[model samples]
Target: MPAVTADTLTLPRLPDLPQTATAWRPVREVVRAREFLEGEGFRVRRPFPGVGLANADPFLLLDHMGAVEYGPGEAKGAPWHPHRGFETVTYMIDGALEHRDSAGGGGLITDGGTQWMTAGSGVLHSELPPQDVVARGGLFHGVQLWVNLPRAEKWTPPRYQDIAARDTTLLSSGDGGALVRLVAGDVAGFRGPGATRTPITYLHATLSPGARLDLPWPEDFTAMVYVLAGRGTVGPERRPLDEGHLAVLGRGGALTAHAATPWDVLVLGGLPLNEPVARYGPFVMNTRAEIIQAIEDHQAGRLGRTQVPHVTAADEELS
Candidate 1:
Protein backbone atom coordinates (compact mmCIF):
# COMPACT_ATOMS: atom_id res chain seq x y z
CA MET A 1 0.00 0.00 0.00
CA PRO A 2 3.01 2.29 -0.36
CA ALA A 3 1.62 4.28 -3.30
CA VAL A 4 3.70 7.32 -2.40
CA THR A 5 5.22 8.31 0.91
CA ALA A 6 6.58 11.46 2.56
CA ASP A 7 6.88 12.96 6.00
CA THR A 8 3.88 15.29 6.28
CA LEU A 9 5.58 17.68 8.66
CA THR A 10 8.26 18.32 6.08
CA LEU A 11 5.85 18.89 3.16
CA PRO A 12 3.80 21.87 2.07
CA ARG A 13 0.47 21.98 3.88
CA LEU A 14 -3.00 22.79 2.57
CA PRO A 15 -4.63 25.95 3.81
CA ASP A 16 -7.00 25.46 6.72
CA LEU A 17 -10.66 25.86 5.86
CA PRO A 18 -12.60 28.61 7.57
CA GLN A 19 -15.33 27.24 9.84
CA THR A 20 -18.28 28.89 8.06
CA ALA A 21 -16.76 29.99 4.82
CA THR A 22 -17.54 26.93 2.71
CA ALA A 23 -19.86 23.93 2.62
CA TRP A 24 -18.91 20.29 3.14
CA ARG A 25 -20.13 18.00 0.39
CA PRO A 26 -22.73 15.48 1.44
CA VAL A 27 -22.58 11.77 0.76
CA ARG A 28 -25.04 10.46 -1.80
CA GLU A 29 -24.29 6.74 -1.58
CA VAL A 30 -21.66 4.21 -0.49
CA VAL A 31 -21.25 1.38 -2.96
CA ARG A 32 -19.10 -1.66 -2.21
CA ALA A 33 -16.80 -2.87 -4.95
CA ARG A 34 -17.68 -6.20 -6.51
CA GLU A 35 -14.84 -8.63 -7.14
CA PHE A 36 -14.03 -9.67 -10.71
CA LEU A 37 -11.14 -11.46 -12.42
CA GLU A 38 -9.40 -9.36 -15.05
CA GLY A 39 -6.32 -9.55 -17.25
CA GLU A 40 -5.24 -13.19 -17.34
CA GLY A 41 -7.46 -13.94 -14.34
CA PHE A 42 -6.13 -11.61 -11.64
CA ARG A 43 -8.81 -10.55 -9.15
CA VAL A 44 -9.91 -6.90 -8.94
CA ARG A 45 -12.62 -5.07 -7.04
CA ARG A 46 -14.62 -2.89 -9.41
CA PRO A 47 -16.89 -0.31 -7.79
CA PHE A 48 -18.62 1.43 -10.66
CA PRO A 49 -20.30 0.88 -14.02
CA GLY A 50 -22.19 -1.57 -11.83
CA VAL A 51 -23.51 1.53 -10.10
CA GLY A 52 -24.35 2.84 -13.57
CA LEU A 53 -22.14 4.88 -15.89
CA ALA A 54 -24.28 7.97 -15.35
CA ASN A 55 -23.00 8.15 -11.79
CA ALA A 56 -19.42 8.18 -13.03
CA ASP A 57 -19.76 10.37 -16.09
CA PRO A 58 -16.51 10.98 -18.00
CA PHE A 59 -15.26 7.91 -16.10
CA LEU A 60 -16.17 4.45 -17.32
CA LEU A 61 -14.57 2.09 -14.77
CA LEU A 62 -12.54 1.79 -11.57
CA ASP A 63 -10.65 -1.46 -10.93
CA HIS A 64 -8.88 -1.95 -7.60
CA MET A 65 -6.21 -4.65 -7.79
CA GLY A 66 -4.88 -6.63 -4.89
CA ALA A 67 -3.18 -6.00 -1.61
CA VAL A 68 -2.97 -9.82 -1.77
CA GLU A 69 0.38 -11.53 -1.37
CA TYR A 70 1.14 -13.87 -4.26
CA GLY A 71 3.15 -17.06 -4.03
CA PRO A 72 5.67 -17.94 -6.72
CA GLY A 73 4.08 -18.60 -10.12
CA GLU A 74 0.73 -17.16 -8.96
CA ALA A 75 0.99 -13.66 -10.34
CA LYS A 76 -0.89 -12.70 -13.51
CA GLY A 77 -1.36 -9.77 -15.89
CA ALA A 78 -3.48 -8.49 -18.78
CA PRO A 79 -2.84 -10.07 -22.16
CA TRP A 80 -2.46 -7.92 -25.28
CA HIS A 81 -5.65 -6.04 -26.01
CA PRO A 82 -7.17 -3.16 -27.97
CA HIS A 83 -8.92 -0.01 -26.83
CA ARG A 84 -10.37 3.09 -28.43
CA GLY A 85 -12.22 6.28 -27.53
CA PHE A 86 -10.88 6.41 -23.98
CA GLU A 87 -7.83 6.53 -21.74
CA THR A 88 -6.41 4.13 -19.15
CA VAL A 89 -4.64 5.32 -16.04
CA THR A 90 -2.78 2.47 -14.36
CA TYR A 91 -1.22 3.31 -11.00
CA MET A 92 1.16 0.80 -9.42
CA ILE A 93 0.88 1.10 -5.71
CA ASP A 94 2.94 -1.84 -4.48
CA GLY A 95 4.51 -3.79 -7.35
CA ALA A 96 5.85 -3.60 -10.87
CA LEU A 97 4.13 -3.98 -14.25
CA GLU A 98 5.52 -3.84 -17.77
CA HIS A 99 3.41 -1.98 -20.30
CA ARG A 100 4.20 -2.19 -24.03
CA ASP A 101 1.93 -0.98 -26.74
CA SER A 102 2.04 -1.10 -30.55
CA ALA A 103 3.14 2.52 -30.66
CA GLY A 104 6.11 1.53 -28.46
CA GLY A 105 4.88 3.65 -25.56
CA GLY A 106 5.45 1.95 -22.21
CA GLY A 107 8.00 0.81 -19.65
CA LEU A 108 8.34 -0.67 -16.18
CA ILE A 109 5.67 0.94 -14.00
CA THR A 110 6.73 -0.10 -10.53
CA ASP A 111 6.11 1.06 -6.99
CA GLY A 112 4.41 4.43 -6.83
CA GLY A 113 4.56 4.92 -10.57
CA THR A 114 1.81 5.35 -13.18
CA GLN A 115 1.19 4.68 -16.88
CA TRP A 116 -1.35 6.95 -18.58
CA MET A 117 -2.38 5.71 -22.00
CA THR A 118 -4.77 7.35 -24.41
CA ALA A 119 -6.46 4.89 -26.76
CA GLY A 120 -7.82 7.56 -29.00
CA SER A 121 -8.55 6.13 -32.47
CA GLY A 122 -7.35 2.67 -31.27
CA VAL A 123 -4.20 0.71 -30.34
CA LEU A 124 -3.00 -2.69 -29.19
CA HIS A 125 -1.40 -2.88 -25.76
CA SER A 126 -0.39 -5.49 -23.21
CA GLU A 127 0.16 -5.27 -19.47
CA LEU A 128 2.22 -7.97 -17.87
CA PRO A 129 4.16 -8.47 -14.66
CA PRO A 130 7.89 -8.20 -15.17
CA GLN A 131 9.28 -11.76 -15.41
CA ASP A 132 10.61 -11.46 -11.86
CA VAL A 133 7.15 -10.85 -10.41
CA VAL A 134 5.81 -14.08 -11.85
CA ALA A 135 8.91 -16.17 -11.18
CA ARG A 136 10.01 -15.03 -7.73
CA GLY A 137 6.58 -14.01 -6.45
CA GLY A 138 5.74 -11.01 -4.25
CA LEU A 139 2.99 -8.55 -3.43
CA PHE A 140 1.19 -6.83 -6.29
CA HIS A 141 -1.44 -4.10 -5.97
CA GLY A 142 -2.58 -1.30 -8.22
CA VAL A 143 -5.52 0.60 -9.76
CA GLN A 144 -6.66 1.08 -13.35
CA LEU A 145 -9.10 3.87 -14.12
CA TRP A 146 -10.84 4.30 -17.47
CA VAL A 147 -11.40 7.93 -18.38
CA ASN A 148 -13.68 8.64 -21.29
CA LEU A 149 -12.61 10.97 -24.06
CA PRO A 150 -14.99 13.56 -25.47
CA ARG A 151 -16.43 12.82 -28.89
CA ALA A 152 -14.29 15.56 -30.42
CA GLU A 153 -11.07 13.99 -29.13
CA LYS A 154 -12.07 10.38 -29.67
CA TRP A 155 -9.77 10.11 -32.68
CA THR A 156 -7.07 12.48 -31.59
CA PRO A 157 -4.18 10.00 -31.40
CA PRO A 158 -2.78 7.19 -29.29
CA ARG A 159 -0.23 8.28 -26.71
CA TYR A 160 1.15 7.49 -23.24
CA GLN A 161 2.71 9.06 -20.14
CA ASP A 162 4.99 7.49 -17.55
CA ILE A 163 4.62 9.33 -14.25
CA ALA A 164 7.17 8.16 -11.70
CA ALA A 165 6.57 8.44 -7.97
CA ARG A 166 8.86 11.43 -7.59
CA ASP A 167 6.99 13.21 -10.38
CA THR A 168 3.81 13.47 -8.26
CA THR A 169 3.01 16.74 -6.53
CA LEU A 170 2.86 16.06 -2.79
CA LEU A 171 0.96 18.03 -0.20
CA SER A 172 -0.39 17.69 3.32
CA SER A 173 -3.43 18.57 5.41
CA GLY A 174 -3.57 21.83 7.31
CA ASP A 175 -2.47 20.22 10.55
CA GLY A 176 -0.22 17.65 8.87
CA GLY A 177 -2.71 14.90 9.64
CA ALA A 178 -2.65 13.40 6.17
CA LEU A 179 -0.43 13.08 3.10
CA VAL A 180 -1.72 13.84 -0.40
CA ARG A 181 -0.22 12.74 -3.71
CA LEU A 182 -1.74 14.70 -6.56
CA VAL A 183 -1.74 12.50 -9.66
CA ALA A 184 -3.72 14.59 -12.18
CA GLY A 185 -5.54 17.89 -12.67
CA ASP A 186 -5.63 20.73 -10.16
CA VAL A 187 -6.06 20.70 -6.40
CA ALA A 188 -6.60 24.15 -4.92
CA GLY A 189 -3.81 25.83 -6.90
CA PHE A 190 -1.35 22.90 -7.17
CA ARG A 191 -1.51 20.44 -10.09
CA GLY A 192 -0.49 16.86 -10.85
CA PRO A 193 1.72 15.45 -13.60
CA GLY A 194 -0.97 13.68 -15.62
CA ALA A 195 -2.22 15.54 -18.72
CA THR A 196 -5.86 14.57 -19.28
CA ARG A 197 -7.98 15.23 -22.33
CA THR A 198 -10.92 15.87 -20.05
CA PRO A 199 -11.25 18.03 -16.95
CA ILE A 200 -10.50 15.87 -13.91
CA THR A 201 -8.61 15.58 -10.65
CA TYR A 202 -7.03 12.34 -9.35
CA LEU A 203 -5.20 11.90 -6.10
CA HIS A 204 -4.17 9.39 -3.41
CA ALA A 205 -4.17 10.25 0.27
CA THR A 206 -3.08 8.55 3.49
CA LEU A 207 -4.45 9.68 6.81
CA SER A 208 -3.31 9.03 10.36
CA PRO A 209 -5.85 7.56 12.77
CA GLY A 210 -8.53 10.06 13.72
CA ALA A 211 -7.32 12.53 11.15
CA ARG A 212 -9.63 14.43 8.86
CA LEU A 213 -9.02 15.81 5.37
CA ASP A 214 -10.80 18.96 4.28
CA LEU A 215 -10.28 19.35 0.55
CA PRO A 216 -11.06 22.34 -1.63
CA TRP A 217 -12.98 21.02 -4.59
CA PRO A 218 -14.33 22.20 -7.92
CA GLU A 219 -18.08 22.58 -7.76
CA ASP A 220 -18.51 21.58 -11.40
CA PHE A 221 -16.94 18.16 -10.97
CA THR A 222 -18.58 14.97 -9.77
CA ALA A 223 -16.78 13.77 -6.64
CA MET A 224 -16.20 10.38 -5.03
CA VAL A 225 -13.81 8.81 -2.56
CA TYR A 226 -12.70 5.17 -2.61
CA VAL A 227 -11.06 3.58 0.37
CA LEU A 228 -7.98 1.51 -0.46
CA ALA A 229 -7.12 0.34 3.07
CA GLY A 230 -8.53 0.80 6.59
CA ARG A 231 -11.75 2.43 7.79
CA GLY A 232 -12.99 5.94 7.33
CA THR A 233 -16.06 8.18 7.23
CA VAL A 234 -16.99 10.65 4.47
CA GLY A 235 -19.01 13.84 4.20
CA PRO A 236 -20.57 16.12 6.77
CA GLU A 237 -22.94 13.37 7.90
CA ARG A 238 -19.98 11.10 8.60
CA ARG A 239 -21.21 8.24 6.45
CA PRO A 240 -19.21 5.05 6.92
CA LEU A 241 -16.69 4.05 4.23
CA ASP A 242 -14.52 0.97 4.51
CA GLU A 243 -12.03 -0.75 2.27
CA GLY A 244 -13.38 -1.53 -1.22
CA HIS A 245 -16.16 0.96 -0.65
CA LEU A 246 -16.81 4.09 -2.73
CA ALA A 247 -18.69 7.13 -1.53
CA VAL A 248 -20.30 9.18 -4.28
CA LEU A 249 -20.65 12.75 -3.13
CA GLY A 250 -23.15 15.49 -3.76
CA ARG A 251 -22.72 19.15 -4.78
CA GLY A 252 -20.45 21.44 -2.84
CA GLY A 253 -17.23 23.40 -3.20
CA ALA A 254 -15.44 21.19 -0.69
CA LEU A 255 -15.26 17.58 0.59
CA THR A 256 -14.20 15.93 3.85
CA ALA A 257 -12.85 12.58 5.03
CA HIS A 258 -12.49 11.62 8.67
CA ALA A 259 -10.40 8.58 9.41
CA ALA A 260 -11.34 6.06 12.06
CA THR A 261 -7.97 4.37 11.71
CA PRO A 262 -4.92 4.66 9.54
CA TRP A 263 -6.40 4.85 6.07
CA ASP A 264 -5.39 5.06 2.41
CA VAL A 265 -7.86 6.37 -0.12
CA LEU A 266 -8.18 7.66 -3.66
CA VAL A 267 -10.17 10.84 -4.32
CA LEU A 268 -11.25 11.58 -7.85
CA GLY A 269 -13.81 13.61 -9.82
CA GLY A 270 -14.25 15.14 -13.21
CA LEU A 271 -16.55 17.40 -15.19
CA PRO A 272 -19.49 15.35 -16.41
CA LEU A 273 -19.20 14.64 -20.09
CA ASN A 274 -23.00 14.32 -20.17
CA GLU A 275 -22.72 12.28 -23.35
CA PRO A 276 -24.11 8.88 -24.25
CA VAL A 277 -21.69 5.99 -23.52
CA ALA A 278 -22.01 2.76 -25.45
CA ARG A 279 -19.50 0.12 -24.42
CA TYR A 280 -18.49 -3.51 -24.97
CA GLY A 281 -15.62 -5.72 -23.70
CA PRO A 282 -12.84 -3.12 -24.20
CA PHE A 283 -14.25 -0.55 -26.56
CA VAL A 284 -16.08 2.54 -25.34
CA MET A 285 -17.96 4.76 -27.69
CA ASN A 286 -20.89 7.16 -27.82
CA THR A 287 -23.18 4.77 -29.69
CA ARG A 288 -23.75 1.07 -30.24
CA ALA A 289 -22.93 1.56 -33.91
CA GLU A 290 -19.64 3.15 -32.93
CA ILE A 291 -18.86 0.26 -30.61
CA ILE A 292 -19.57 -2.14 -33.46
CA GLN A 293 -17.27 -0.14 -35.67
CA ALA A 294 -14.54 -0.39 -33.03
CA ILE A 295 -14.86 -4.16 -32.87
CA GLU A 296 -14.81 -4.36 -36.63
CA ASP A 297 -11.75 -2.14 -36.79
CA HIS A 298 -9.97 -4.29 -34.22
CA GLN A 299 -10.91 -7.57 -35.88
CA ALA A 300 -9.76 -6.12 -39.21
CA GLY A 301 -6.40 -5.24 -37.60
CA ARG A 302 -6.87 -1.51 -37.73
CA LEU A 303 -5.94 -1.03 -34.07
CA GLY A 304 -2.40 -2.29 -34.31
CA ARG A 305 -0.51 -5.53 -34.77
CA THR A 306 -0.31 -7.76 -31.71
CA GLN A 307 3.16 -8.90 -30.77
CA VAL A 308 3.17 -11.41 -27.95
CA PRO A 309 6.64 -11.47 -26.50
CA HIS A 310 6.95 -14.26 -23.97
CA VAL A 311 9.35 -13.23 -21.26
CA THR A 312 11.89 -15.82 -20.23
CA ALA A 313 13.79 -16.34 -16.99
CA ALA A 314 16.94 -15.05 -18.66
CA ASP A 315 15.04 -11.89 -19.57
CA GLU A 316 14.28 -11.34 -15.90
CA GLU A 317 17.95 -11.65 -14.97
CA LEU A 318 18.92 -9.08 -17.57
CA SER A 319 16.16 -6.61 -16.66
Candidate 2:
Protein backbone atom coordinates (compact mmCIF):
# COMPACT_ATOMS: atom_id res chain seq x y z
CA MET A 1 0.00 0.00 0.00
CA PRO A 2 1.17 3.52 -0.75
CA ALA A 3 1.71 5.87 2.16
CA VAL A 4 -1.03 8.48 2.45
CA THR A 5 0.07 11.97 3.46
CA ALA A 6 -2.13 14.86 4.48
CA ASP A 7 -1.35 16.64 1.23
CA THR A 8 -2.45 13.63 -0.83
CA LEU A 9 -5.41 12.59 1.27
CA THR A 10 -7.04 15.71 2.65
CA LEU A 11 -8.96 18.28 0.67
CA PRO A 12 -8.71 21.96 1.50
CA ARG A 13 -11.20 22.79 4.26
CA LEU A 14 -13.81 25.46 3.76
CA PRO A 15 -13.91 28.23 6.34
CA ASP A 16 -15.61 27.24 9.58
CA LEU A 17 -18.86 28.88 10.56
CA PRO A 18 -20.46 29.46 13.94
CA GLN A 19 -22.74 26.69 15.04
CA THR A 20 -26.12 27.35 13.46
CA ALA A 21 -29.25 25.30 12.98
CA THR A 22 -28.83 22.88 10.10
CA ALA A 23 -30.58 24.07 6.97
CA TRP A 24 -31.43 21.45 4.42
CA ARG A 25 -31.06 22.15 0.73
CA PRO A 26 -34.20 21.89 -1.36
CA VAL A 27 -34.64 19.39 -4.14
CA ARG A 28 -34.18 21.17 -7.46
CA GLU A 29 -35.21 18.29 -9.69
CA VAL A 30 -36.01 14.59 -9.48
CA VAL A 31 -34.77 12.42 -12.31
CA ARG A 32 -35.08 8.68 -12.74
CA ALA A 33 -32.27 6.41 -13.89
CA ARG A 34 -32.81 5.60 -17.54
CA GLU A 35 -31.68 2.31 -19.06
CA PHE A 36 -28.80 2.44 -21.52
CA LEU A 37 -26.12 0.24 -23.05
CA GLU A 38 -22.45 1.05 -22.67
CA GLY A 39 -19.02 -0.60 -22.60
CA GLU A 40 -19.43 -3.66 -24.80
CA GLY A 41 -23.14 -4.35 -24.24
CA PHE A 42 -23.32 -3.91 -20.49
CA ARG A 43 -26.70 -2.61 -19.32
CA VAL A 44 -26.89 0.38 -17.00
CA ARG A 45 -29.20 3.03 -15.61
CA ARG A 46 -27.87 6.50 -16.38
CA PRO A 47 -29.50 9.07 -14.14
CA PHE A 48 -27.53 12.06 -15.35
CA PRO A 49 -27.20 13.03 -19.03
CA GLY A 50 -30.72 11.68 -19.45
CA VAL A 51 -33.83 13.45 -20.72
CA GLY A 52 -34.60 15.86 -17.88
CA LEU A 53 -31.13 16.10 -16.34
CA ALA A 54 -27.92 17.13 -18.09
CA ASN A 55 -24.31 17.23 -16.84
CA ALA A 56 -23.84 18.11 -13.18
CA ASP A 57 -20.82 20.44 -13.25
CA PRO A 58 -17.75 18.40 -12.31
CA PHE A 59 -19.69 15.16 -12.71
CA LEU A 60 -20.00 14.22 -16.35
CA LEU A 61 -21.84 10.87 -16.15
CA LEU A 62 -23.09 8.21 -13.73
CA ASP A 63 -24.05 4.63 -14.58
CA HIS A 64 -25.76 2.36 -12.05
CA MET A 65 -25.22 -1.30 -12.88
CA GLY A 66 -27.45 -4.20 -11.90
CA ALA A 67 -28.50 -5.64 -8.60
CA VAL A 68 -29.64 -8.44 -10.88
CA GLU A 69 -28.40 -12.00 -10.83
CA TYR A 70 -26.31 -13.15 -13.74
CA GLY A 71 -26.48 -16.75 -14.81
CA PRO A 72 -23.27 -18.60 -15.56
CA GLY A 73 -21.43 -17.07 -18.51
CA GLU A 74 -24.06 -14.38 -19.03
CA ALA A 75 -22.08 -11.40 -17.80
CA LYS A 76 -20.38 -9.18 -20.40
CA GLY A 77 -18.69 -6.11 -19.00
CA ALA A 78 -16.79 -3.20 -20.54
CA PRO A 79 -14.16 -4.26 -23.01
CA TRP A 80 -10.91 -2.58 -24.02
CA HIS A 81 -11.25 1.16 -24.48
CA PRO A 82 -9.45 4.44 -24.05
CA HIS A 83 -10.25 7.47 -21.94
CA ARG A 84 -8.80 10.93 -21.60
CA GLY A 85 -9.31 14.30 -19.87
CA PHE A 86 -11.25 12.78 -16.95
CA GLU A 87 -11.30 10.25 -14.18
CA THR A 88 -13.37 7.07 -13.84
CA VAL A 89 -14.68 5.91 -10.48
CA THR A 90 -16.15 2.42 -10.08
CA TYR A 91 -17.85 1.49 -6.82
CA MET A 92 -18.76 -2.13 -6.28
CA ILE A 93 -21.78 -2.99 -4.17
CA ASP A 94 -22.29 -6.76 -4.48
CA GLY A 95 -19.96 -8.34 -7.03
CA ALA A 96 -16.41 -8.35 -8.34
CA LEU A 97 -14.91 -6.38 -11.22
CA GLU A 98 -11.42 -7.04 -12.56
CA HIS A 99 -9.63 -4.04 -14.00
CA ARG A 100 -6.43 -3.62 -16.05
CA ASP A 101 -4.88 -0.59 -17.64
CA SER A 102 -2.17 0.25 -20.16
CA ALA A 103 0.11 1.66 -17.49
CA GLY A 104 0.57 -1.81 -15.95
CA GLY A 105 -1.98 -1.27 -13.20
CA GLY A 106 -4.61 -3.90 -12.43
CA GLY A 107 -6.78 -5.05 -9.53
CA LEU A 108 -10.10 -6.46 -8.43
CA ILE A 109 -12.77 -4.20 -7.04
CA THR A 110 -14.88 -6.61 -5.05
CA ASP A 111 -17.97 -5.98 -2.99
CA GLY A 112 -17.65 -2.64 -1.16
CA GLY A 113 -14.45 -1.80 -3.03
CA THR A 114 -13.71 1.14 -5.34
CA GLN A 115 -11.37 1.72 -8.28
CA TRP A 116 -10.48 5.36 -9.01
CA MET A 117 -8.57 5.87 -12.24
CA THR A 118 -7.31 9.10 -13.70
CA ALA A 119 -7.27 8.85 -17.47
CA GLY A 120 -5.26 11.99 -17.75
CA SER A 121 -3.57 12.45 -21.10
CA GLY A 122 -4.85 9.01 -22.14
CA VAL A 123 -4.97 5.33 -21.17
CA LEU A 124 -6.39 2.05 -22.43
CA HIS A 125 -8.30 -0.09 -19.95
CA SER A 126 -11.04 -2.64 -19.46
CA GLU A 127 -13.43 -3.67 -16.66
CA LEU A 128 -15.01 -7.11 -16.59
CA PRO A 129 -16.34 -9.80 -14.28
CA PRO A 130 -13.77 -12.26 -13.00
CA GLN A 131 -13.96 -15.79 -14.36
CA ASP A 132 -14.97 -17.33 -11.04
CA VAL A 133 -17.90 -14.97 -10.68
CA VAL A 134 -18.81 -15.47 -14.32
CA ALA A 135 -18.87 -19.25 -13.97
CA ARG A 136 -20.68 -19.38 -10.63
CA GLY A 137 -23.11 -16.58 -11.46
CA GLY A 138 -24.32 -14.38 -8.61
CA LEU A 139 -25.53 -10.91 -7.76
CA PHE A 140 -23.87 -8.06 -9.67
CA HIS A 141 -24.22 -4.46 -8.65
CA GLY A 142 -22.08 -1.33 -8.96
CA VAL A 143 -21.88 2.27 -10.15
CA GLN A 144 -19.49 4.07 -12.51
CA LEU A 145 -19.02 7.84 -12.23
CA TRP A 146 -17.09 10.12 -14.56
CA VAL A 147 -15.43 13.14 -12.98
CA ASN A 148 -14.31 15.85 -15.39
CA LEU A 149 -10.83 17.32 -15.07
CA PRO A 150 -9.98 20.98 -15.27
CA ARG A 151 -8.02 22.14 -18.29
CA ALA A 152 -4.88 22.70 -16.25
CA GLU A 153 -4.73 19.03 -15.17
CA LYS A 154 -6.41 17.45 -18.19
CA TRP A 155 -3.14 16.12 -19.55
CA THR A 156 -1.55 15.02 -16.29
CA PRO A 157 -0.06 11.55 -16.16
CA PRO A 158 -2.47 8.65 -15.62
CA ARG A 159 -2.72 6.96 -12.25
CA TYR A 160 -4.85 4.47 -10.31
CA GLN A 161 -6.05 3.89 -6.75
CA ASP A 162 -7.60 0.50 -5.96
CA ILE A 163 -9.25 0.82 -2.58
CA ALA A 164 -10.49 -2.23 -0.73
CA ALA A 165 -13.76 -2.10 1.17
CA ARG A 166 -11.94 -2.17 4.50
CA ASP A 167 -10.04 0.99 3.60
CA THR A 168 -13.15 3.17 3.38
CA THR A 169 -14.02 5.41 6.30
CA LEU A 170 -17.30 4.31 7.88
CA LEU A 171 -19.38 6.56 10.08
CA SER A 172 -22.58 5.70 11.92
CA SER A 173 -25.35 7.86 13.29
CA GLY A 174 -25.76 8.27 17.04
CA ASP A 175 -28.91 6.13 16.99
CA GLY A 176 -27.25 3.61 14.68
CA GLY A 177 -29.99 3.78 12.09
CA ALA A 178 -27.78 5.48 9.51
CA LEU A 179 -24.35 4.56 8.18
CA VAL A 180 -22.05 6.31 5.71
CA ARG A 181 -19.09 4.98 3.75
CA LEU A 182 -16.86 7.79 2.60
CA VAL A 183 -15.02 6.80 -0.55
CA ALA A 184 -13.42 10.12 -1.47
CA GLY A 185 -13.29 13.70 -0.17
CA ASP A 186 -14.04 14.90 3.39
CA VAL A 187 -17.31 14.45 5.22
CA ALA A 188 -17.91 15.13 8.88
CA GLY A 189 -14.11 15.25 9.45
CA PHE A 190 -13.36 11.88 7.90
CA ARG A 191 -11.32 11.85 4.68
CA GLY A 192 -11.54 9.05 2.12
CA PRO A 193 -8.57 7.19 0.66
CA GLY A 194 -8.75 8.29 -2.96
CA ALA A 195 -6.99 11.53 -3.97
CA THR A 196 -8.67 13.72 -6.56
CA ARG A 197 -7.51 16.76 -8.49
CA THR A 198 -11.07 18.06 -8.35
CA PRO A 199 -12.34 18.83 -4.88
CA ILE A 200 -15.32 16.53 -4.24
CA THR A 201 -17.00 14.17 -1.84
CA TYR A 202 -18.37 10.76 -2.75
CA LEU A 203 -20.34 8.77 -0.21
CA HIS A 204 -22.69 5.82 0.10
CA ALA A 205 -25.27 5.85 2.86
CA THR A 206 -27.81 3.40 4.26
CA LEU A 207 -30.71 4.61 6.33
CA SER A 208 -32.97 2.38 8.33
CA PRO A 209 -36.69 2.98 8.65
CA GLY A 210 -37.56 6.35 10.19
CA ALA A 211 -33.95 7.33 10.30
CA ARG A 212 -32.71 10.83 9.55
CA LEU A 213 -29.22 12.02 8.62
CA ASP A 214 -27.97 15.61 8.56
CA LEU A 215 -24.63 15.96 6.77
CA PRO A 216 -22.73 19.23 6.44
CA TRP A 217 -21.47 20.06 2.97
CA PRO A 218 -19.51 22.75 1.16
CA GLU A 219 -21.91 25.48 0.06
CA ASP A 220 -20.38 26.03 -3.35
CA PHE A 221 -20.37 22.40 -4.46
CA THR A 222 -23.06 20.85 -6.66
CA ALA A 223 -24.74 18.15 -4.58
CA MET A 224 -27.03 15.30 -5.55
CA VAL A 225 -28.23 11.96 -4.28
CA TYR A 226 -29.39 8.78 -6.01
CA VAL A 227 -31.55 6.29 -4.17
CA LEU A 228 -30.32 2.78 -4.83
CA ALA A 229 -33.00 0.99 -2.86
CA GLY A 230 -36.30 1.66 -1.06
CA ARG A 231 -38.01 5.09 -0.76
CA GLY A 232 -36.94 8.18 1.10
CA THR A 233 -37.55 11.86 1.78
CA VAL A 234 -34.89 14.47 1.11
CA GLY A 235 -34.19 18.16 1.85
CA PRO A 236 -35.94 20.61 4.19
CA GLU A 237 -39.33 20.03 2.54
CA ARG A 238 -38.77 16.27 2.83
CA ARG A 239 -39.45 15.67 -0.83
CA PRO A 240 -40.39 12.04 -1.40
CA LEU A 241 -38.08 10.05 -3.67
CA ASP A 242 -38.75 6.49 -4.71
CA GLU A 243 -36.24 3.85 -5.72
CA GLY A 244 -34.21 4.58 -8.87
CA HIS A 245 -34.83 8.32 -8.50
CA LEU A 246 -32.05 10.93 -8.27
CA ALA A 247 -32.51 14.24 -6.49
CA VAL A 248 -30.47 17.27 -7.53
CA LEU A 249 -30.07 19.56 -4.55
CA GLY A 250 -30.08 23.32 -4.39
CA ARG A 251 -27.59 25.57 -2.57
CA GLY A 252 -27.26 25.00 1.17
CA GLY A 253 -24.79 24.33 3.94
CA ALA A 254 -26.17 20.91 4.75
CA LEU A 255 -28.14 17.93 3.39
CA THR A 256 -30.93 16.12 5.21
CA ALA A 257 -32.48 12.82 4.24
CA HIS A 258 -35.11 10.80 6.08
CA ALA A 259 -35.90 7.20 5.42
CA ALA A 260 -39.54 6.17 5.15
CA THR A 261 -38.31 2.63 4.71
CA PRO A 262 -34.81 1.20 4.64
CA TRP A 263 -32.96 3.14 1.96
CA ASP A 264 -29.57 3.12 0.26
CA VAL A 265 -28.34 6.25 -1.47
CA LEU A 266 -25.19 7.45 -3.21
CA VAL A 267 -24.29 11.05 -2.41
CA LEU A 268 -21.90 13.06 -4.59
CA GLY A 269 -20.83 16.70 -4.54
CA GLY A 270 -18.09 18.62 -6.32
CA LEU A 271 -16.83 22.12 -7.07
CA PRO A 272 -17.76 23.14 -10.60
CA LEU A 273 -15.05 23.42 -13.27
CA ASN A 274 -16.82 26.44 -14.84
CA GLU A 275 -15.05 25.82 -18.16
CA PRO A 276 -16.20 24.72 -21.57
CA VAL A 277 -16.97 21.00 -21.92
CA ALA A 278 -16.30 19.41 -25.27
CA ARG A 279 -16.92 15.67 -25.45
CA TYR A 280 -16.60 13.07 -28.14
CA GLY A 281 -17.33 9.45 -27.27
CA PRO A 282 -14.95 8.42 -24.42
CA PHE A 283 -13.01 11.66 -24.58
CA VAL A 284 -13.88 14.81 -22.65
CA MET A 285 -11.90 17.91 -23.42
CA ASN A 286 -12.15 21.68 -23.22
CA THR A 287 -12.02 22.07 -26.97
CA ARG A 288 -13.05 20.14 -30.10
CA ALA A 289 -9.43 20.25 -31.31
CA GLU A 290 -8.33 18.44 -28.16
CA ILE A 291 -10.97 15.78 -28.72
CA ILE A 292 -9.69 15.24 -32.23
CA GLN A 293 -6.14 15.01 -30.92
CA ALA A 294 -7.20 12.35 -28.36
CA ILE A 295 -8.72 10.24 -31.10
CA GLU A 296 -5.65 10.66 -33.23
CA ASP A 297 -3.42 9.71 -30.33
CA HIS A 298 -5.39 6.52 -29.72
CA GLN A 299 -5.20 5.59 -33.40
CA ALA A 300 -1.47 6.26 -33.48
CA GLY A 301 -0.77 4.20 -30.31
CA ARG A 302 0.23 7.24 -28.29
CA LEU A 303 -1.69 5.80 -25.35
CA GLY A 304 0.43 3.14 -23.65
CA ARG A 305 -0.10 -0.42 -24.80
CA THR A 306 -1.34 -3.31 -22.66
CA GLN A 307 0.55 -6.62 -22.33
CA VAL A 308 -2.41 -8.85 -22.95
CA PRO A 309 -3.73 -8.00 -26.37
CA HIS A 310 -6.69 -10.37 -26.56
CA VAL A 311 -7.88 -9.95 -22.97
CA THR A 312 -7.25 -6.22 -22.66
CA ALA A 313 -5.42 -5.23 -19.46
CA ALA A 314 -7.11 -7.55 -16.93
CA ASP A 315 -4.41 -10.22 -17.01
CA GLU A 316 -1.47 -7.89 -16.38
CA GLU A 317 0.05 -7.57 -12.92
CA LEU A 318 -0.43 -4.26 -11.17
CA SER A 319 2.61 -2.01 -11.24
Tens digit of per-residue lDDT, candidate 2, span 1-319 = 1111122123333223333566668999999989998876778999988677887989999999988789998877888899999999999988889998876677888888888888888889999999999898988989999999999999888877777787776776544567777888987677877777899999888878997777789999999999988899998888999888999999988888889998889999999999999999899999999999999999999985533222112222232
Q: Where does candidate 2 stray beyond 4 Å?
A: 1-20, 305-319
Clashing pairs in 2: none
Q: Candidates' TM-scores?
A: 0.94, 0.89
Indicate which candidate wins on TM-score. 1
- Among all windows of 10 consecutive residues in model 2, the one with the lowest summed lDDT is 1-10
> What is the per-residue lDDT of model 1 for residues 255-313, given as tens digits with 9 covering 90 to 100?
99999999999999999999888889899989999999999999988896433233322
lDDT of the candidates, in the order given: 0.88, 0.82
